[model samples]
Target: MNESGNPSQPVNVNEYDASHIQVLEGLEAVRRRPGMYIGSTGERGLHQMVYEVVTHAVNEHLAGHADTIDVTITADGRIRVADNGRGLPVEVRESTGMSAVERQLTELSFAPKPRTGYWVFGGINGLGLCVVNALSSRLTVEVHRDSHRWTQEYEKGIPISAFTRHEESSGHGTAIAFMPDADIFETTRYSFATLSQRLQELAFLNGGLAISLTDERPERPVRHQHLDGLHAYVAHLNPYPSSLVHSPAIGFTSENEEQTIFVQVAMQWNTRPPGEFRSFANSTRTHEGGTHEHGFRTALTAIINDHARRQHLISPDDEDITAEAVQQGLTAVVSVKLAHPVFEGCTRTRLGNPEANTYIQETVREHLAVWLDHHPNEAAAIIRHILNTSI
Candidate 1:
């Protein structure tokens, strides 16, 4: 203050606070590099736009929602997703005292966490909503909860209107309808088969969960199986010409205060194809196969090798039972749980956690070994098949 020897503006405490927090508003960056958020500007990304919208509903389903999701590709080219679950937040902002819905639709980095962790993070990235809104020419979000329905409209993530309460009868859930921006994405159309495939998998993996996918664009609607859950999933995907000893799938699930894990093991001697297994944190597939998958793979390989050596099924000089050699025709699914999910990349969302590896490995190792001992014939057959395949 004395450096200038003038009435140096009395150093004020409030004025000394850190510089104004820098923030990129609206869909500014998303529009600049759409691929950075949605992965690519190709068909995959086009499909991703739909996924981004439907994931919210699927997430609600996981959280014990009202149940039922309706997806329709309107003739007018509007993709509509409706789900029975807690609706997106639309309360008043405590800071600006403005409607939360208005702010989220109009601003960047504005999203509500259903829970502390990304447990309900069905969105591709935290940018799921923003990305979709930014990529769409027009967007509308309707929320039905607490016996009241509210509506809001936006243009590319920027709210154009305030939330309006609608008095609708016999309605509860969230509906999102958006028209993709042709300028932002090359193709704005969606593939029903691809979408159906993903939905069918979710239905199969989640027992007692009913998911329906209908393509109104085509006169003949393609329907998928709604029952059988993971058990059916394994059977359907089981190897062809399998000499299964009839090893029923064993499903194990555990949840801590932070995470939830669901594991299903279906082992049979099949002559169809290579082994297949996947891990999931929430509904999003862990394409890379995280810790839980690692443990499952390791334990399975080790267990098979141990059984083979003890049964004298293979000569001591045989190979070390590589993952590929052992999983020639086996099928299993290992799903992990994480409190705060940190998905890899924006579009290719996969679970990233080290602890899941230990849990899955230990559980499968202890249980599968005992299962093998209990069912000698099945274990021996599998090990023999693996050894034979290796040879």
Candidate 2:
């Protein structure tokens, strides 16, 4: 109590100063907040670590360096990804003063070249490899380039040894093997089904790009590859002839030079109930339909309605066909590649690029209109089916 009999103010035990704050260097920040980088520490995050590494290889393929990527899950729960791409550059980058290999492994802000129409690379945020390194118990990278093979090793994101050069090698590529840290992930073992499904999607999305996933845990290893691209994907989803109302799926590709956008669509009407409408932006699946999907729906509905009206299949006074009605008994795959894609969230399940809406709409409308005109009989059948449902 004070002499004045009033309550005394509490004393400031410690002054606020710079010393109170601590700084985390290297990949320590990633370990501290793993979710911010990989979304979760559960199975999704574990699988995401694998995806991050594979994405780098896929980017190399897109850059015209590689043609095939091989992903294998070893018996010991380690993941090894190898690509026949022009290996990672061994030269030191002036900005960071670290070799490309070292910077990619240790630095969080290190980024490759910006994506362009020539190559639709996926890892734009630059957190891929570093995040994988930070979350792995051990990581080893080998690059075969310039007639020599170079190697480096790291333990939980820290360099265990300096880069070493090996005997001359003829082939060129990059290989990364990593074991997820048991302390960071809920589970270290990976699901073969999940990995295969994702790898197949990547292969389908990038036509001519070969990706193989192999499981070595089983007595007889299982391998999966898809080469027919989206066409095969649509057929795989609806395999039975009884399920498909159309014999052959309608597929097309279109590109906009000005917007630097490329879109591919494969669709077929089925006898079974309406199937899924799968969509992707830059190889990432968008489960929640965004501008790209919206554009697709708009184009489908508009084209169908216009064709029906022209063929006198519907009364002139009838209301325009609803998007849902147009999509009934429809199975479709829509993939778009753009240089600057604005995804809705970190999960990247939705695309928000406004320009994509216009580009996709125009492309679908024009190409589909011509198809409908050329195949009058098939177009009439589809219109009739839709009209019957509308009634």
lDDT of 1 by residue, 169-215 (tens): 36678888999888888887788788887777666656666666666
TM-score leader:
2
Give me the runs in candidate 1 sitting further than 4 Å from their true place.
1-24, 94-97, 116-120, 168-170, 220-227, 239-250, 256-267, 309-320, 345-351
Clash totals, every prediction: 2, 0
Best by lDDT: 2
- Which portions of model 2 miss their true places by more than 4 Å? 1-15, 93-97, 115-124, 219-224
Clashes of 1: 2
TM-score of 2: 0.93
- What is the RMSD, in Å, between candidate 2 and the native fold over all Cα? 3.3
Please report, in order, the local distance difference test score of every candidate based on alpha carbons.
0.69, 0.83
Clash list (residue pairs), candidate 1: 204-229, 291-357
What TM-score, over all chains together, does every model reach? 0.83, 0.93
